[model samples]
Target: MPRRQHITVFAILALFAFIGTSFVLMFRSQPQGADYPGPTSQEPVLVDNEILLGTATAPKLENETLKAELGNAAWKVLHTTMAKFPDKPTEEDSQALKSYIHLFARLYPCGECARHFQQILAKFPPQVATRSTAAAWACHVHNEVNKSLKKDLFDCSKIGDFYDCGCADDGPVKGKEKEKEKDGFKQLELEKEG
Candidate 1:
């Protein structure tokens, strides 16, 4: 392994470790709040910097386009992550993906969207047992979300071809496994500790 590559991998791992720990502590310390059940167009948000045991309030969206764009971008990254998940993930790998899915629900900038995802997750936990299952799972949940919003549904059968990472196009890229994609890597909290 090259020295620079090793260092980068080490750094990303460390970052995830730190974020995961913070999330655990935060979860333990969340203050009591009103219970909100079911889907809502607007949801409570964790204030910036206060996410480590923060309050949930409805964040005002300046416009409709912003919300749509954010949700679209987040879904793209999430679907792509599922597409690239290992064919047969180990316990740790599966846990990482699972944790990321939940963490994403918390960190999603749109409070209501986050709440909706959390509700969706409760109904359909992340299926990270294998690549095909995980991808299909993502598509199903996304369709559920679409149904809730009265949006067009996507066909799961074509998801694999729709979100190819292109990593396989030129054969396997060595060291690619350690390299973090932008998707949810930036928000990798709730990690599974070994």
Candidate 2:
């Protein structure tokens, strides 16, 4: 194979390995709450009126259209991340996820939205022990936001179907493989025609 082809194959193999490792980590059951530091255990968040007033250090993005777009995209990322969380995560993984969530709320672009998210986090706290719990928690929190916004609530039971990341046991590229094979056949036909 050409150098480029070799590199592509290697990259695909590496991706498969990483995904496989994630699956293994997710399935390996750890004791419930063995390593998770719940909100009560974590350092207290100082109540800042600036954050509540939408005037914190994070820039206030007030564009309504942009805010909606950002909110939708952020929700997608959150749901997918929770969906992929390990079934039995290590203490480190659990802590990292919880930390990431708090930071994500703090750093969200729209100051108003961030404040709302902070309140939500304060109320819900992240459920990071198992993948199912994490995903369900995400869905519940999302519904809470939707309820506040007067938006239609999503079916939490169908969350797995909605946020399917294609990280199935079979592989991520089954459909891609078929498409690539078809494209290769088309390229061969074109070459013959030429």
Candidate 3:
């Protein structure tokens, strides 16, 4: 009787252990944390709705050479605008431009160009002063890149009488005989009146 009771107690413990192990395994199999799914399981950071319009991916301003090129381009654009409307940019425009430059630096990291620009900005300092001008410039560069890419991707139609309706109708008589016939009747009326 004693042996049977000992066996029964051991069996019950074993069953409980099995059940506990199964529960743990089941829990482990399920994903934890926020229920929201992200871009990839490997990507630690997920940016939602941060996609730039007209682009599947951001412009890759990776190397120092590229950075210098972008900087030159941006500077040229800003300078031209400033020249065109001397007082129009104001403090805000300067700040915005500086911000754009900094952004380009971060993306491209042209050491020489960045150093030169930094010194110039420090001495002259654009109208609007920000706490971290360099950092702001970095962000601005990104904005500029995005803006440029968007502009290149999407070309708006000019508002004018001239328009391409995407139809291939050369010399006005390939597909509308009825319309042509109506015009002919108007010409006949004018002739009869004359």
Q: Which candidate is the best by TM-score?
A: 2
> Candidate 2: TM-score?
0.58
Off by over 4 Å in 2: 1-56, 169-194
lDDT string, candidate 3, 22-105, tens digits: 999999977888476645867665322232111122244458677767666765554333223222345655555545544433
lDDT (10s digit) by residue, model 2, range 41-62 = 4677653434332332466786
TM-score of each predicted structure versus truth? 0.57, 0.58, 0.24
Q: What TM-score does model 3 achieve against the real structure?
A: 0.24
lDDT of each: 0.73, 0.73, 0.42
lDDT of 1 by residue, 56-130 (tens): 244645677999998889889999998788867898899778777777776778877777777888788778777
| Model 3 alpha-carbon miss at residue 155, Å | 36
Task: Give candidate 3's total backbone clashes.
Answer: 8
Error of 3 at 8 (Å): 61
lDDT of 2 at 107: 80
